[model samples]
Target: MVLEREILPYFQWLLGGEGLGLGALPQFGLVMLGLALLALIGSYLFAAARYGPLGGGDLVFQTVSSGFREMWEISPRRIWALARLAVKEAWRRRVVVALLVFFVILLFASWFLRTDHQDPAKLYISFVSTATTYLVLGIALLLSAFSLPSDFKTKTIYTVVTKPVRAGEIILGRIIGFSLVGTALLAVMALCSYVFVNRSLDHSHQVEEQSLRHDSLGGEVLGYQGRTTLDASHRHDVQLNNENNGQALGNHGHSHSITARGDGHVVSAAEGIMRARVPRWGKLKFKDRQGVEKELGVNVGNEWTYRSFIEGNTQGAAIWTFEEINESLDPAGEGLKIGLIVRVFRTHKGIIGEAIGGAFQVRNPETGVQSELTFFDAQDAKISEITIPRKLVGTDNSELDLFKDLASNGRLEIVVQCLQRGQYFGFAQPDCYLRLPEGSATWNYVKVYLSIWVQMVIVTSIGVAASAVLSGPVAMMLTVSFVVLGFFREFFVGVATGTEYGGGPVESLVRLITQMNVISPLEAGASTSLIKGVDAVLQSLMLSVAQVLPDFSAFSTANFAAFGFSVPTDRVLQDLTTCLAYVAGLAVIGYFLLRTREVAK
Candidate 1:
């Protein structure tokens, strides 16, 4: 329900842009600039009306222009001085008290969070990440919003304003100072949370040779009943290959894969399960029922609309084209490791937990040679790994070298399809990728925190900007409102565009008044037309607002860390750019707002 109410709308907007071949960034920028200009004009008009001609438009322009120039020429010393004062002010307001609350939560979390269920590691990671995010964000908002307003209330602002200080400098000081505080808080919390999770789930079990029995054919020692020695808390049942070595494997909740050492036995812990994976993303292509190459498949009955599903028992197929293949990249020498997260949508439940059958095939474009279809049983909502061997022997017992024969100019195609009738396989662009080993899990963990820091910066900047024109409590409320609304911007867009079940706000109100069902068409009448007209107007306004607000959910990287996936460099860069753009815009708005304020008066 939250996905539909919040996440679905933003994704729907993205899909709409993709379908229409429109660039989202340019459109977003234009809308944002337009809104900014409108706000500037509205502020100018209000100032003119309140302060009369001399103190109105002319005074506002003078103040803004002078403040802008002064801001540009402001010395680092002034900014730092104000920053230090802000830090002291935050301490005066007892912001560190929030950190104490965070500590208490971390200490008591073990009692409430059930680790006996599936994927305790994932649950722990999710809990810590969510807790730290909310706690840090709240503290940042409070500091940014109240610092300046508190100064105004105590007449301390007058002392700063009357000096050689510009309003923009004050804003910059608040943002930088509060950000430092937030950074410190977040750093401590992240470290503590990580340590807490690691210590809490620090479990290990010893495997003995007596517990393992040798298989006749493979000559490999297999653990008893596919399980190993049980510890007091938990036990690992690691699978071994023909060489009697444990293979790398993962479950939904793990932050990394677990592997056994020589002799098919090793001590395993939560920390041992984590290892960094580097993914080689490939370009995806789809073939329609008519076998024509297409960009993507048609959407199934999914409300999220993020992934497209190919019909089962049909000619439709999703193909991934991988390039730059070499033996060096495949360190294991066993084959190429492809990680896939496929969503299975079953039309009928044959049996609960019964995996559906899927097929993966490797084909050569130039030689028309293809490998045997690799059949794998895929569970719904789980990631499956399939390894493609370097050599594919044909039915005639002829060996086809994967890199030498199948690869066309070092390019290979892997096709995915659903083998079962009435069962669909859903995939997005990010669902499947080649797992290229990279940095450790600890390094990737740091990157996730960096993404959260970017979000905190944005919130702090907005809070400071709001305080430029609003009272302390009002500014805090406004900042909090922005966060809540930004998180659900897509939901507002859906309502405005009649994409939600109840249609636009006005139409929903009308339906409520007339006791009409949401799905049914309205009866033909003057009232219906009037209601529709009002709805159209309201939708247009809401749409304009939605276009300007940043989608806060886009900054979250908790899922990536929780699922043992590396946060891509491109994603981190994109988030940083987005944060900077918003901060710049808000800084400009704050400058103009603070310039017109009568701080000295």
Candidate 2:
């Protein structure tokens, strides 16, 4: 899969420093413990100032001992019963109204979505997945954030408090109930979206009889070529032999399978139009015009620098080093199928609209033995496919086996270069790949939905934790702020660490006021010293908050289904682990918060 943002594998992510990894658990625990101690000290100071030192000490001891006691005394039966009650309460509140809201939004959604889009599958997938995600998360936020608070408002919580139900159980019960409700809604939405997208994109073109041409000399009937009638705002060029069988060429990222009919063939959409393309990706590095190896290629003047360009016609080339390229990668022995999403850029559009020439070369990493250049016209914004046969004629015109000569120790380097001197080819790490056997598109869709589900659970957990201590509106706002901040946590972390050029929040603000560029150094003085001093404290606070907030963006895999790539299993596992961690941590925190509240007591 082409990862726009890099993600670590399960083990690496679990044990790494980035995000809420298990390796950082000890440090996080220490931080939590330190905060707890600070809170205890703060309470004692307030109590001592009002009462006495001995009285303050006694109160702190009671609070600590009771909080632990309340948590430990949780009964499974009581928890389940409370969960059911919360579920009933949610139903009574008509949470399923969320589904109606979704349906109503979707009813008028067609006004914005264009049926004639070139990539209908992508557009539809993105729309449905994004819509479902926001709707479900919004429901979770409202339901979880307001459930306990509303109970308190109505004094309904007093009845439960008078019963054997503990404060800890209430928090856990609310989380479980809200999660169950959200899960049911998510499943329904996923099903509806599946049907909706398929219905909207499903279309077939009729054979244009007048457009058909027969290759006949005299009376002999030969093959025929024709154009298909317009359907879904597009048409296709088609050809068939006397047997009345042929495939339609690909257009709009899809092709048609012509079913032979009496007079002409009926065109049907091909299976791969919406498929899970399992691709074996390789690590990409660039060789400069001077033939020096580098991590990145030239940055073409694009605002989005996801793709880098290489100078054409020179020794400059974008190379992918593929590891684990064995006979298994090509079990059929037909060849290794290479797929490319090329970004063609031009210094000048020489012929107004002409494809630039590009070439591919495979080299043995160990022996430096390279294959002869395989050339093709590089079209802009199109996926190009090429097959490398098992047998090959090398640049020296010597016979060679693709496996034996080119791939050394299962490592092969494929170089892509723009053949036109004035032209350039842009590539990201995921832009080129070795196509493997396709996986089930259904399973891929399920995985993306699973990602959305994890996100919902996380949001609900955050809201519940906040609501345990704050009012409903405040809790909702806090949850929303956390989610929004989570999206930019990495950048926030960067600023906190002084890695970003403009510095921290205050320093950046100063830069904005002075109209100074990020690269310039601020003039050193007491004002600057004071600015730095204040920014340091702010940075420290930002860093702490960044670590606690969930990285919500990591849970989105809708792009996987849209791009036709199967979602990576490791990422799903990583997300699941992250969600469970948040749920567990927040449950503990919420339990303590609820225990301190008068309503719960």
Candidate 3:
């Protein structure tokens, strides 16, 4: 005869390991593609610098060079001349300078803010950028509009015009001058800000380092320990036999116990009569057969069987065990210990294990005592157990990473058995420290400054172009109106009150203004169904008149940058083209108006 050895079953999981299917490349490529495009444009512009117009380069330089022209020949001069003029003028303009200085201070102070917080830089950037743009645009517009107009009023243009200078060239020169002054001030501010931000980062890094050091000290000097105690409220409910899984009474006066016998057999003690059924293989037996009895609220299913061990009359609290299985009579008609199945139940307050499923054997080194126990999952209708069984041995197994996979399972949690449980859940503390940077790289700050500068230039251009065509006071009024419109124009409409289709109440007019261009033909058609009461007025305007506004929200990217949302590059290009086209068209109209009008006395 051959020897029969124990065999361990290995389950081959059919799950496919996580693999890449090319989804990652698209996201990564998009950012790389954008940076590539930016680089290409920069290179192209740099290469074409010696060529004709560097886009709109002539405007401001011409304005300043014309100021010193001899009224005879229109010849070229170094561009830096106008740049110098702007700085001198900006220095004299205390109002604008004060605002710029204040904003610079704010920028520097922003570095001190808690950068570790989510989106703080984004919020700070958006607010500061928008405000800085307004300031720069206002000052630039005021300077540019008054630049030539003031000369015209003083009749200084006649002298300058009679010289070699052209009117266009003069306007260009003034723009260049102001841009230079603005650029220098911006450069200084950027340097300071970049220094501050780097210093802040250094300080943050130092603090983190010190915190790690302190954690090491804490771990070494003041030993710590911890424990996970199950609250009495969320205890386990169980029984000893196969009948009482669901019908077990809640918090009744009853208890059950299980004991291990010397013959490697488990004896369950309950209040039911000791009955045994013979199985095909063996006869069932218990150490104490007289303890088995039935009490109250007994129910059984295939999964669980037990005596209704807890009495219905008893109160306060109690626990029990249960099982669910029947044994068949053998050929010899002898009682057998086979066919017993273990089941666990959840009570309203505690969990009960009827027949212990499997025993986790543990030994205490100090006492030299061994114990066998079975764990249950639920104690009440709502409660669930979070138990982890660990077998302790001589050497510490805590550092070993075995059984980590079992910990991830929802019900079958695994935890290490430690000599001392204190190290189980302790969090290390940190230290306090600061550090500073020692360099002059300020590219980010410069970019912020440049972005603000360009936006202001655009805004001032709009206002100046208007002022160039209108009378002084009218120009001022128009400038202020447009500026106000830029910031608060949404208030004039009712869409600010609610959504067009009552999707929800609008938080503010600003959100409504931003959505002005989100037009869909289907939406236009859908508007008819939204005709109800006073809201109908809003619907009508949204479907018709409000479409004419510049969608000041379209010009805004606050939500995109501040809220960490996508702003499609195509949309940026489209909106930028639209705004430029509109500005140009408006300026043309104003030019015609100016050309036809004679100066009033």
Candidate 4:
């Protein structure tokens, strides 16, 4: 029952909102991809700062040096030479080699660290965008700090200062060269990731389309195992036939006890209950394959059983069972033998064993008058008996759960029979039948789509991102930490909200005992926003914080997908934009800062 708001409606908005047709463009995943690409580029620039001739100082020096040379109308060759010197000098540093080696190792390792997941679109896009930013940023910082410090130590600035080349050119050129190289590497990685993601998305789209080819219908099906129980007040209708001398029984809502004596006819206390049964030897109508009508002959027989009463010393009452007889008998003779059979199985009174020996008629409770069906033969056994509800009969052996074209097949033909008293019998019970038709139920797609992707993207993005910024040792440490954190963000958040120290005793204990803990510091980060107000500020900060490591919360859309909800494309775009903007922005700013700072020579 989770609504769109629960998973952040990005997909909902992108898929053309609720109930809208699929958009021409797959907006949400695309938007996220765009932002991820942007971030990838930003991270690349930051990484490239190491291998080039210029350093951070080159920006200021390049502007001044270039401006002066322009005024003097110096040759373009001289300007090019100066730029080349800056790049060559920077590349000669051991720090540049070390940084490039580190980046290349990470980039290559990423290729082998494949996930077993079937869907790779979100996972691939998320990993590349996040991992590149973090790696490039760290490399940029290391190169900037290491190379600049060496330049100072070796007094290299003094030599460069004597030349026409300005300090800014040295710094800015270093930044540009490193940026160019790193960005190129990242662009390749991003392209590969994009291809992987699109393949996954395309596969997902095909699956959905394939499923829509057929329709599903649902309805109530009575899975009667032997028998079905009904409430005491339950009632059913019985059809009457004039040719069979059929009379609907149990019509007046009166309860009756039927007893079969050593007699040919059944006696009933309530005339209404006794009259409902149709004579077994009667003409029945059914349809043949060519839509033609046919008649079935039913024969009734009387067998004796007893209704045993447990309340008053286990009294026995007579009951009868009717069996159908089939023979080539004349139509006129059928009337003399045709009659209904009533069998009683359950009763409020007690239990039954055999047929009664002598009783033939019974006094009605309503009229206080006697009603009779036959004479007592005295030779039938005097068996124990109990009054019970009458039984209905049907073949009920269909292979399928639902009946096909039930109405068109015509009404079902069967006799109502129950074992009452000591004899096998039939009572005026309602006829049994069934019908099957097409029907529908509602399904939700928003939640289904949202739950799946939300968790996937959120977990993979944050996990890889955290791995990027840390040292080889620290990266592994952060990877494990972020993986757990990503999986249990809400649980950790709740702990943070309720704990005295805002995180938990675990965090507090760790702080007191050691510098390290299982929960990530980045867990406290917020998500970003697209709006433009105080709310937007809060949202932006939240989004930025959420991306601090790699929030995989968005990929939890699997649950929604299971529920058959459609995800909108826009929401994915928003998330991607927010994440990419933050990461890339951070990387770019880090790059700019790195370009200004001097690196060790």
Candidate 5:
């Protein structure tokens, strides 16, 4: 439900084959290499102007030789000593007080974080993760930006420079030291956040014995239906049988155990309410009212085109072709769980506040034979689940097994149709998926924090690199500006690639002055040609900048966790690799910057 689009694996996303796939590394390396070459040529030209041609060559050779020598002869012990000193210095600066602040916020968090919230888990996780991210990133930026600059300001850097400590060592030492501190802070906070979210969402319910009613057919008792005692401001509608009296419907993101207590049912073990449901996504296609296959369905006049609409009381339906069906999908031998999140768009006021009715049925892809419809009511944007019985009834009233008769040759076609007139069902490809199984909720929460940590690493590196050549306040400004730009990296790409409206910056300004629509082209003339020419150049520059920016959107995975979906392992690996690459590049850049900076030379 959180994922509106199908996620390609990391390798596929980066156009790499497999394993620790090369993602943006090829292009990133080329850019860095080009910049390094430019820096070398520029340094040599500056030296020549200042110290004559022959002396310039000597200076250049000495700089390059010393750089290589320092790299090869770097001492880990010396770096560790300096890193330990940094840790002591940070303690002296009262960095540990940030954790106290985090604790205080958690203590008072319940005042605003309502326990009765419809999705308590999502609310708690969002608040905790967001608060922790801002706190940690703020601490990192402030600490790293001021650390080296303050040493230089107090002339304490002179003491360290007198020793054999290499410029590279100083930079790496500071990065590692601050990273360790941030890691410690993050770990404690992660544990506390985990506890806070779980505790805030923790509650249990008991079965309401008085509410039990017999589910009987032909004067025989089949099962019992009842309601659970209210807890956490909500109750569950339960259905159970005496044979295996443990199954119950999920009410608040989880289901409770309903066991037979003598003649009565007992509901207990309210576990796994906030869960990560592993889903196997299928390929989505559309069928028009005339029953013709199409690539996409009708767009129902919405600006955000994430979901397409299927008209009601017609042949319009969304078809999902699921492949590689196997017994593992139904390991318990129970029916397959079909999870759906759909949006109901109503044009008629018939039966106000009632949910729209929709039908789901499976078809054989090869034989085109379809099963009888399974109906469920859908509310707007609400997630509904239905279990397709192991034995399905065909349209011809023949009982057919789900695996053998309908799901032909390991492929299953599920069709979704809206039954009411003047109502529409809108859904994206990810709106419907077969729920496979659940993973650890705690593990999923940790993955969310892992993403936050990567972001912290990136911000800290930016701060340190900027501080290498800039004053504390100015470096803070630079890092902040970079982070702001990073958050809008997608928007920048959109404009640069002309996917979004309003052309390039120059063209946008032109449109603003003339009050022209973003979609409209500039009026043809000599002046327009000149404007467009400048825009073209600007677009290329914009693209180059966009490619270099940190992808902040990709680093955030709260939605996936919040909506009870497992974050892909490849995504985590790709982000960690990206963080490492950024750190390595920043460390090198910081070394060179300090080498040529005023404090050193």
Candidate 6:
């Protein structure tokens, strides 16, 4: 799904040892060792060329050995003192200006943000998350990139370097101090954003039984109006089910599904405007057009290559096997709530927004009895839900308990198939799942913010490391360039691995010059061969570069929070580990650069 070729290179490298019980630490250690060896070899060659072979050996060894020893010789007192100095300098430089700017942006955001969107909660969360990320990153980059360079320009770095502080200590102190300030700023901004969103979205409408129009059966209400108004321009139209429990819709672009309270007449809307389902993920299998069972669906025409599609009107079907059925987990007891976000590709559109029909089937594994397929109209590119009842009558007119009779050894199998002749259903693993009860939105919000902080840590560390060797402007430029490159690291890897079209950078340039498309083969000639050769070299270099850069996309949890999904613990740990590894490598590089630099000179 999602073009594993593009994203999996990094994930595979990082998570490969997950099953080996080593985690990413072993892979990280190996990489660090390789870098260390490369640096040592480069140093040896340079020394040998500059000085007669053996003359610079002692110099190289001393530098390497001393740097290694000095890494552990850090004094907490000296580091703390430098940290305090760094904080004081940051204050003097008016770093608080960034925080003030953040507040101003947040205060004026309501004027620009559309609160009447269909999912205003998603919009608000996305806006706040994006805005906070950009602001925090900007502040981190500025403070970290300019601090040491500014000190060097004013010859103030000599005051600290002259003391008993190691070069490593200076780097560490600066990182910690700057990170502390950034973290504090982020925490404050996050809290304010949370409060702002809550206040803006806090709304309720009055529902009276007399205002509702009942159906002929008198069990359901058709069109019901709420008395209370919201947002100055909108009122709610409430719809009640047979038990007088259902949903209410607001004209200003929001709706709420309700549940029955103590009495059937007394109903209340579900808690929280932003809520997500905790899914009991099941293992997926497939049946091909030949009715042969397979592990996955056939890949359809998608340039991005993210999802697989099941052929409609064919024997092809996607089956999900679920185990460990715990009825206690579900308070409804009505059935299993299944949520789906299916993408439809219509070969022929009879009418616009015309839904393709699909069917869901439940089979009894022990008795070989199956229920008649329940038909549902499938809308493309939107979330839809269905309920599978705990009790159902089989084809033989025998009643089956879903948990006791149909399910074998706590396992239940569900089959999904498209019924339309030409329409197709495209989906990935996460497209469909069982909808469990919602978790705390506030906790999810905090998790996303934490992810942003991890990103800040990475940017700040790289900035400080660059500043150790380069001048102020150059260091800033370098750090910024690395950040931009990190954002597209996966793309670079794709090109390098030949997964992306046009081969690599050189081939891409040639294609652009020659007005050739990606699918078109390069003409056979000396020029084409030369271009291909150069691209191979470039791809090698790009691959090496990608290995060192952080996978910035992995640290992004905005989508998860905005879409109301809990950020998985495994994902969080993976990103944090990757960030720390990059920081460690940068720290070592900074130490070496600072140790060799003649600051006083």
Listed per model in order, the count of residue pairs whose N, CA or C atoms clash below 3 Å is 1, 0, 72, 139, 0, 0
Alpha-carbon shift of residue 549 in model 4 (angstroms):
15
Query: TM per model?
Result: 0.86, 0.92, 0.36, 0.25, 0.89, 0.87
Give the winner by TM-score.
2
Residue-level lDDT of model 1, residues 13-79, one tens digit each, is 3333545554445665776679767876886788779988667887668765786687679778888
lDDT of 6 by residue, 116-175 (tens): 675677788888888889889988899999998888889988888777778888998898
Q: How far is 538's C-alpha from truth in model 2 (Å)?
A: 1.0
As for candidate 6, its clashing pairs are none
lDDT of 3 by residue, 337-415 (tens): 2122222232322223432222222223233233333333222211111222232222333321112222122112111
How displaced is residue 310 in candidate 2, in Å? 0.9
Per-residue alpha-carbon lDDT of candidate 2 for residues 166-200, written as tens digits (9 for 90 to 100):
77888888898888889999999998888888777
lDDT tens readout by residue for model 5, 1-601: 5565445676665554556465466767777887788778998999999999889879888987888788888899998988888788888989989999999999999888876777777788788888988899888899889988999899999888788898889888888888888888999999998888877787777777788788888998888887888888888888877453855677666778877777666666657656787777898999888889888888888998888889999999999999988677888888878888889888887696777899989999998888999888986776777788889889999988888887759999999999999989998888888987778878988898899899888888888888988999999998887788788888888888878898888889988998999987778999888988898898898887776689876688887777778887877887888899888888888888888866645
Question: Across residues 478-511, which tens digit of lDDT does each residue of candidate 4 receive?
Answer: 4456555656665545444442232343444545
In model 3, the worst 10-residue window by lDDT is 426-435
Could you say which candidate leads in lDDT? 2
Full-model lDDT for every candidate: 0.75, 0.84, 0.36, 0.34, 0.83, 0.76
At residue 590, give the lDDT of candidate 3: 39
Instruction: RMSD for all candidates, in order, please.
Output: 4.8, 3.0, 26.0, 28.5, 3.3, 4.2
Reference-based TM-score, model 2: 0.92
Candidate 2 to native Cα RMSD, angstroms: 3.0
Name the TM-score of candidate 3: 0.36
